[model samples]
Target: MSLNDASCTFESMTSPTTLKTSTEPPLVSAVHWTRAQWLLLMVVCTVLALDGLDVSMVGVALPSIGQELNLGTDSLQWIVSAYVLGYGSLLLLGGRLADLLGRRRIFLIALSVFAAASLLGGLVDDPAILIATRFIKGLAAAFTAPTGFSIITTNFAEGRERNKALSIFTTFGASGFSLGLVVGGLMTSLSWRWTFLVSVPIAVVVVFLGMKFIPKDKPSAENSGHDIWGAVTLALGMLGLVYTLVSAPEQGWGSVATIAGFAVSIAVLAAFAVIENKVKHPLIRFSILKEGWVARANLSAVGLFGSYLSFQFIVTMYLQSVLGWTPLGMALALLPAGLLVATSAPFADRLIEKFGATQLILTGLTALGLGYVLFLRVGTTPNYVLDILPSVVLLGIGFALAFPSINVQATAGIKDSEQGLAAGLIQTSTQVGAALVLAVTTALVSGHGQAAGTVSAQAMLEQYRPGLILSAAVAIAALLVAAAPSRRRVRT
Candidate 1:
């Protein structure tokens, strides 16, 4: 829910030297970076930032989309969910592909996929085709995101250098989301199509630079065939569940269609567990989850990101439909939050050292929960200074502290070879959480019994309140997870 635009994981490369399962990394941060290493980092970071930009811009673009396409609330919701559905479902598989195939290959291939999708998306006339393009873009991002992280972790030594690289990476990633809010707004003023079209150039430039400067990866000798059945079942299952949630408002929770969809999804996901346990080259090692940090960190990520994105979705809607602001005005209003995220993400490492991951995670969730609560104060009339600014500032502060810590917690004990898997799992948690929770909350807003009958500004406020309350509740749950007492602990 946290990303209106938020996310990534996976890769591609070929070489005679077989990539090994050795726990050692290829590059060490202890050594000074070559000009080449710095360039690689910058390019990869830019690509990651692009993903965030896509998300933020799209959030603002949604209102324009609805007006142009003459879409109802549910169709508008699908525009976002389509992307989340594809991205969340494939993340784990994408991560494994990176490890088996090669990070560089997957990275390059995924970037190309993303650019091509964006180009087509901008040209589409039908909402269905546009939704399809969003899904395709998400699939490409699922591969690119984790692969980029793997590239960084595998290259940098643990400790100051790795930490520093990650901090800088988080900064750029946040920058994309923040900047995208503004850029999308400005571009949307020209036409909403520009939002989808704009990423084309950025992705193309990044791929071109990547081909030259990004080092080639050795193919894994351990390259086993992918878990076809597991991937298929998981994808279908997640899609079904999301569809059920999205349709529940209309279909009724106890309706035959809703029940059947939920039933099938559960059965399929259970089957996926069976296949993972039995397979020799399981898509993911179930045992890795035995580590408490890995499992809990991922669960917390789901809640944290879910609430964040869901909140953004509602806020953007309120800005355009209720307050009657243009997309550019909405972007400038949110510019502070983005600025806060950029300024604060760099210092998160220092905060981690001082307060530790657990405390910081707790603090971040608390800030986020409070921000949503503040947002509930908005009415038919607007007061940006008091009502919205506080929420954005708090949300920004919360994300800066939590996002990087969540990553550190998820991947800390993972082996260098398995870093991609760890990255994929957590990223999956982020996307799936966003996809599912967003659907559920959106249904809550538009669902049959709960909100107002009309789609007017006052009616939307009534609908939006319930969703914001849900967002706050989700954040509280994440905070509780962070604060939970546990016998097992991993490095924060």
Candidate 2:
């Protein structure tokens, strides 16, 4: 039956048999998977894949990018930090705009912009332009990521069908991230620019499919009203805070710029909170904060993702610099971790349903902590089979288990209207955590490098050992938080 007919039928059914009647229709009948929907989802996943590739690929290409551009250790960070800042800061606003405008429209626009930005990044000769392009690329990602979720959630009916679709969507996201590492390695072997240019064709195809398949849905009344002041304040606040975090490792904590950034961040975020409370249409609904599960889930994501990103960065440096491995070799060594992350996710989903989100998250955190502790053994003596492989496998399993569980819990008790906002918030916490931890770890490594003359690869590896241990400690803390009475008491 057509979607219009299905809607009419749904409206007409008011009796106890409504549930029965609803089931009588084909599962796909509820919402037609038009060419538009298929194209949109494909492109969304593809764009996300590109985002993942850019992130992982840059790290693989960093040495080359740095060598060519003559970047110092501290300035090199801008390539990563700039993209994250733009992506994280604009996510919430992007979601709101998708809800207010249209998901299909936004998805297309985002793809086009992302493609252009990728082109710019690839072609740029100057380091400043490269950083600027990365920032712009991130802006495009912010728009696309949240809209992808919103579209799937809105288009698919809830329960098993929605669950399956979301799982598939998330799988693509995870796989894309992992696959990017492999692709980045291969591309960087040819040239660092290929890493960025690779996305152009994918983006172009995604845009074409998005235009064809995704349906055009009118904006809901709640989403139509945009809070300009609230958005501005929130963006400014997040930018200030993230900038402070990214810069702190390079500039001392006592530096004037660092101090001012943090101070302004606190003030602006405080102002944002006040504005949110008073605004007629707030960017984030204050009422959602009262939900215990939502709060815990977001906090858990921050801690969990912080550890994950730091480990990825540290390991990359260790493999290439310390072990005397090429980018391709490092990428190949890390392939098992990515595969494990992908392989474990489906099992993690089933575990979530059976044991609930809290249990799964706690288990995942425990695994992640143990993985880090195991990684402390990684030294100048390269033993992939005995030491590093086991750690990578455990790390992969931990992340695969934790991410989906937290995502489920965060979105679980929210109304449809609030889903986009909640998803945006979760993603924001993830990027912010990554940025913060990376900065902290980089600072520690840099300080150690300076103290030791002619910083050897082994010395750099030793420097990060302390940081990794600390990250493991943080994971243990997260496990405790997840297992706490308050978290356990809250029901989905």
Candidate 3:
């Protein structure tokens, strides 16, 4: 059964509720959406953009940070891995809280926390403290990202209105991260601290705007208990799993500590599964993963983000440390990927509607795979135009197509009450996937003596090349998963 077989429409993959007629009168097309709607959309988009900005900005600043702190690659990776650990681990709980307590409240509080963390991170001279602040920021984002996503889903109608809003929202996020590279470069030139400080003011402004513009809504009555044990086990399990992965290469992959860490992590997660089965109001309803599209979307997210972040990390290192490019020059080199995503925002929804999300995902994955493959040819003194620009442009196009579609598919059939659940699942996949893949990539590169901070450019390239190959392998794996056929079908 070909995925392109005329019978397998986009709708076939979504939940049954997607087919129902709206009780409310139809609003105008998304382009003409009202001021209030637009404001709400902006609120969520800005929050997501802030998340993107913080992550990417820090990425470009990593080298400066390393030099300033006298930190090695292993230590530098913790700046990123800590954030992913905090964000990925608590996301399920964050989503459940948003659904149970109130999206507006959760979103505001988390945004506030994020602002404070950003400020603290900028002021901190201690590497551990700086990394701790990054963790706090990630924890804050775990709540804000999903709540914002759910807010958009609940406000906009499912089919077209929601689609357009999501495309713009996701694009802003991609743009924020994309553009953050350049912004990060500029800030890093001034002082690496500025990258952390820059987002504080923007976040504060967004919080004030959110308090005013975001409509208040009651919590879902369906959820009765907080499922305390479930939250604890899930958090611990995720933390342990991520920790083990992050530490494995350092500890020696086959060492007792690494083996024990994996064992403990698996044990805790198993307990979490048991608790979820028994608890009346589980933090996560495992049944959600049983939804074919939902599961596929999450796996696809893991592959997409895992590969891209790992690729970006390797490139940032190669360009700055090895090639000796200025921060601004490196940012400009990678700007095309972000630019393509920003430019294509308007057309994304239409593309999904016309070609169907399934096809677009397949197309996106193919482009992504090809982009990674192209980058594998990169040498110590490779031509920017011939060796890099083509890959960057292709990656941008891949993201422009895939990110929004994945979001749409993941939440399509979910009830409004469970929208946060759907958002959490996908975002968890993204962060955790990135954390896991990046840990492996870092280990691979670092193990090759790239950690000495004195290796020659040619030697550095040899170490980093394996990370690039891993990125390509990840994309191809995701492409295969996306191409796999679903057992059930409906139409878009």
State TM-scores per candidate: 0.87, 0.89, 0.93
Question: lDDT (CA) for every model shown?
Answer: 0.78, 0.74, 0.86
Candidate 3 residue 149 C-alpha distance from true site, Å: 0.6
Query: Tens digits of per-residue lDDT for model 3 on 267-296?
Result: 999999999999887888888776647888
Indicate whether candidate 1 or candidate 3 has the larger TM-score: 3
C-alpha RMSD between model 2 and the true structure: 7.1
Candidate 3: count of backbone clashes, pairs at least 3 residues apart or interchain: 4
For residue 350, give model 2's deviation from the true position in Å.
3.3
**Candidate 2: residue 9 lDDT (0-100):** 22
Best-first order by lDDT = 3, 1, 2
lDDT tens digits by residue: candidate 1, 1-492: 232101101000011022222353433223367898888899889988988888888877887899998998668767776777677767887887898889999999999999999999999889999999998988898899889888888887654556667767866877798779899888888899999999899899999999988888875556566678877886777667766765666677788998998899899989989998987777777878866368878988999889988887788778887888877888888888788778875576555544445666777888989998888888988678988899989988888878877776677656777888888988888887876677677677666223345667787678678888999999999988777665443322
lDDT, candidate 2, 337-394, per-residue tens: 7887667644554555444456667777888999999989888876899988888888
